[model samples]
Target chain A: MDVILNFIAENLPMITILTLATFVGIEIIAKVPTVLHTPLMSGSNAISGVVVIGAILLIRDAKPDEYLTLIIGFLGIALAMINVVGGFAVTNRMLEMFKKKKK
Target chain B: MERHITDFLYLISIVVFIFGMKGLSSPATARKGNLTAAAGMGLAILIALFSPAEGSFDNHIWIIAGMVVGSAIGLVSAKRVAMTKMPEMVSLFNGLGGATAMLIGFIELKNYQPAVISTVKSLLSNGEAANLMNGEVFSSIFALIIGAVSFSGSLIAWGKLNGSLRDNIKLPAPQIVNLVTLTAIIALSVMIMNGEEMNFALLLILTVLGLFYGVAFVSPIGGGDMPVVISLLNSFTGVGAAVAGLIYGNNIMIIGGILVGASGTILTVLMCEAMNRSLISVIIGGLGSSGSSSGSDREEVVKEATPADLAIQLKYSERVVIVPGYGLAVAQAQHVCHELEQSLEAEGVDVKYAIHPVAGRMPGHMNVLLAESDVDYDKLMELEPANDAFNNTDVVLVIGANDVVNPAAKTDTGSPIYGMPILDVEQAKNVIVFKRSMSTGYAGIQNPLFFGERTKMLFGDAKASLGKLKEELNNA
Candidate 1:
């Protein structure tokens, strides 16, 4: 009984969040109408930017023995930063796609 | 208290991000997507700034400063850039991702220190000393290489989209060079893994090689194949992020990366389908500029009919269909198209806009473009529904669109885009095309729609011509 409780205590956060997020993602995919995909995708891409903050956090807290951890965290932050910036840029460009052409 | 605040901010940012993603799934809410995403980013920044960290402050400051500078550049580009250059903008954005990954990787590698340092006596006596390496160096180096490759590759894609790369018959040597670069990168990865000390010099060299490989990979690819390349590179960025996440064991990084990777891959496939080209054929650089109907040929063939004549034609017609394409997008003439519909309806003529599934560059691209100009949703018809209607239609108006209206797809068995679905504009009684010139679409194939006898070319810019039609119809 103690072992099971310990397992639940250890795994609860990840398990609960993952299950909920996955379920929500699936539900959104199914229930949401197609007309909203454009903004939703852009929003999702923007949300993905949190990975950068996570990276920054890890880099700051990284221990000496965790040199590799810092690097990985840094990398994640950098890539996420790129995604956030690029995704916004692309979205902006896509918006202008219907703008009038100059003669 | 501060830590709790930071975590709360982080959680809120994450929720905003998810909300923004959900908002992006449709055209109606696309504009809102930008604001939602910007808010999420703002939240992320807040979290980063306030959150407690164990590392150097100076680096974080630099990162923050970089974000400000990058955002300024992006804002300026957004305001000043033309619509035609949107694809190039996507390429540039992709380049940012590539470059950022590369920079982060390079920085981590530079700051990297081994877990243990041997004594000076051990180094001198044996003339060899090993420093214990860790996962940080590996992740950093990996990101750098991947990012460098993405940056260069995306730049080339931008160049192609902007017509700077120029259309030409080219060799496949660049692909071979890319293959060589890949092998070297892999070998270098293995070397690094074998407890090698920080080799900044080697990494610098690899970075240069990867940059050259990016240019080489995209240079030979024709404009017709760019959307596929863009999508492919998008997938690469996601994969790079996923790799970085694995290196860090961050739950959010892993989740976000997987989401990007999976969606990007699916989008790449969808984009390839829109081009009516196989993903493999695009990778191999399928004949981008093999066929040519010269500008002079267009000059010789095109005869502009006044809107009065078009109006008269419409008056006599039993049924009329309008095919909206990228030309309509370039002209921003959906409103005028709507006006044309009203005019036709007044004449007791049946009019409908036939939208091909792959009409514009992306899926439902025509619909979104039209929607922005406030075209009625009811008037817009998808390929299948519109195709069924075309058989009885008396006239088909082919706007600035090319590939979608091409009859070659339906009739030409030997064509590269033989099996792709296309608008059956050829079945209509009379086809009137409004175009600036007879340029092929991204597929690099000349549209047979232009050459058909029933097709009358009204040579001009899409918006101007549509505006002209509106004026002429009103006068009538």
Candidate 2:
């Protein structure tokens, strides 16, 4: 019981915050109009980029003793960077589809 | 103490993200999605500051500068970007998720090595092996390889969707190579688990192999299968987040990731169903191949009709219904379509738009494009509602839409898009199709709407054709 309590105490803050955020997000999702869904989904994906940011920070902050953590952080940052750049690139490409011929 | 603040902000950001997504689900509330997402992101950054991780204002100054510059470019481009390119925009969005996953994973891996070794040394001196294992080593290394694959795979999907990657060209023998590389990656993953005596060389080889597999895996898929690919990539992003959450012991990441993965999977299946294709076929498929190539390239099939001829029919008709498709978007003819509707309404003819669910690349795409042209929201009826209006209408004017109005859906079983629900434009008394030429839809199948007895083909640019008809309508 003491061990479980200690475990919960250490990680409780991040957990509670994330849970609340998720609840709120779900609430908003429930009300979303049909026509706006695709764009909304796309935008959400863009915002979820916090994961990349987190990974990069983790890498930069890695203690010399934590080699595995360092490697994982680097991997996360790299992938997230790709997502950010490629996402923007793909979005630009998509927007081009809408360019009208100027008469 | 600082952790509380981080927790509050992270939770707030996640909620905001959800709300933004919800608002985007419907066209009626789409405008709000952008704001909601932005707020969520703002909250997320704020939360990140209070995290257990150390942060100095100086280090973040560069990030702030980058945001400002990025925002300027994003704002300008978003404003200037045409609605027709929305699918590509969606593809790009999916790419971001994949890329982010890969980056985070990589960062995690790179950071773990030294942390593990030091912890191990400390444990050895103190004779505590378990203490070193629980800290960061395993999680970080695992994240790196997974993240790399996600990043490369997403870019390939984006390329395929944007036409930078062609599905028409099947890379033969690549499938076998992909299989072999995948097997090797699995083996490497096992090798990675063999203590923290870091093998950088093996990891590098594995990354290259995974990269090659990612490209080959996504290359053979045609442009038509992009939506499903995007959905799959979305799931991958979710999984990445979940993994990241696990590494950091963040519960929100786990929950959010699971939800995203589940929803994205469902969405992928729905999109596949919409295209009348299976997930397996899409993943390992090539369109514009085995299907109907008989009439697709036939030049003599193009039928030209003047606006005067269409005007004659419209002048006599009591009711007219306009069905818009991707072609209208391509021509930027929504304004013209609205103009045509207004003129028809002025002449005592009832004008309504029959909107298909998946018409014009995305759901409610036609609605947004038409709305931009000042078309009335009430006049635009959904597939079921508009189908009712079609029965009573005298003339069905299908502008720049093919398969949606095709009679072949009713008769052709051999066609890939046979069972898909389509607007029964052919059933109308008089049907006129304004088009550039006889072209297949996204499914790459010829529409039999052209061959319909009542259907008359008016071949030309959709916008120009609509403008000409508008001119004739005014004269009439």
Candidate 3:
């Protein structure tokens, strides 16, 4: 109990940001029409690729002799980059088709 | 100073993501919205590379090489994938995201020894090693479990979507097994967190259990419920990423992950509602397993129609509504369907598409397929509007669609898909369904809509049938 309280007190600001962001997320997403659901899903799936940042940090902070951690971190970076790049590219492709119908 | 700059940029990225999502609320701005979000992601990645860190941060070559290889693979696959196979592609990419999160958690645990030792040393004087737990460590375990589950679950979903995995993989008492695995994982996680030493072996066991639970969780679900599963897994990946963010106190990751998580949850609920099932029932699986036995006993006479007949009826009709499903994509007939629509339109007939929310393998799957064939976006009508329009519609062409238009959903309470919303094609003056045979739909339930007096079945491949119709219409 004391440990949880200490952790909460130390990270209050980040927690607040997360709470507010959740509300904002629901509000924005609830308005997306059914026609765009696929793109909405794929686009947000891309956003979740923000873990690429964590992968970068993992590699940046690894010790010199920690080859195992380094390999794991490298794979993390590569896989995360795949998610980010592939997600966005595929979303763009789908959206482009939607865009062409406008003309 | 560097920290403040990084934080500020991340905040900016968050704002951009919000705007991007807001732009996706309608079709007019959806493409731009996606592009804006991609730009935000790029900005976040660039900022992360230059952000302050404790270690050497000198692994530039490794990072660049990884990015190059990953981007090449991503770009090529994105270009090569057919529009019909989009659901599989999305599932694969989502699995990659989940895998990345799991790896991050693994690496964080590997480097957690120093923190554990220091905390233990500080607590030795107090003789309370149990109180040595902190949020960073807790968040890492959370990420590990959720990420591992999402990763394996999504791969199974992808395999199912692409036909590489069979739909009916029987497990002996699956629910019980899943429950036990979940309980064990939770118990192991708590033990690792509260234990005196960092137990890497126990952590490995927990991860393996999580992965097994994911496979067990998704294996029993029928294919018709895949959209909900995919959406739920997408949210799992998002929540995992958010927890990873919590571990590092990264604002962009927190906000971005939360947004995806929220959106994916909404989509999951929407899909379940479309099918008239509760979230729990969908997760329990087996809705469509016994469908063939219950609905296959009917021996009603089916009326057949030729492509030439359909073409003429369609030509003389005033308003035509086309309902497309997964079969259309399987036959690769979207372009031919579009050609038929254009030919009918040239005859002064009004052509509109009625798109059920769960028409294909994923949400809005049919809309994307038709859009790829250059169909006008204005012509696609959603469920409610399409239902209303059916009252005035002169003809409905159900091309390779089944359950979405099944009248049994309205009349047969004993039907597996009872209470689910349907296209109400029976309300129209004439109905024509294009299929290869009288076989059941993805749900394996008989559609009485096929036997209705107003309905006519045109038996052939959707592409060849539609092509013949187009030729007939042109020659007429």
**Which one wins on DockQ?**
3
Task: Give the winner by DockQ: 1 or 3.
Answer: 3
Per-residue lDDT of A5-48 in model 1, one digit per residue for the tens? 54345445544554465545544434333222332333344344
Model 2, span B286-315: residue lDDT tens:
554556634445544435567997887787
Model 2 stretches astray by more than 4 angstroms: A1-34, A59-103, B23-30, B50-58, B114-150, B164-169, B173-181, B251-259, B276-278, B291-303
Cand. 3 TM to true fold: 0.95
Ranking by TM-score: 3, 2, 1
Show where candidate 1 strays beyond 4 Å.
A1-103, B1-12, B26-37, B58-63, B79-84, B116-134, B168-172, B246-248, B287-306, B331-335, B345-348
- Per-residue lDDT, model 2, residue A61, is 54
Considering the two chains of model 1, state its CAPRI-style docking category: incorrect
TM-score leader: 3
**lDDT for each residue of candidate 3 in A3-71, tens digit (9 for 90 to 100):** 767666777887888888888888887766788888888888888888888887777666666788778
Single out the weakest 10-residue window by summed lDDT for candidate 2 chain B.
B119-128
lDDT of 3 by residue, B418-449 (tens): 88899999999999999999988877787788
Fraction of the reference Cα-Cα interface contacts (below 8 Å) that each candidate reproduces: 0.18, 0.24, 0.77
What ranges in model 3 sit over 4 Å off? Answer: B114-132, B290-295
Q: Model 3, residue B168: displacement in angstroms?
A: 4.5
* Tens-place lDDT digits, model 1, residues B261-339: 5555556566566566778777765454444433324534545566668877877787988998777866777777877
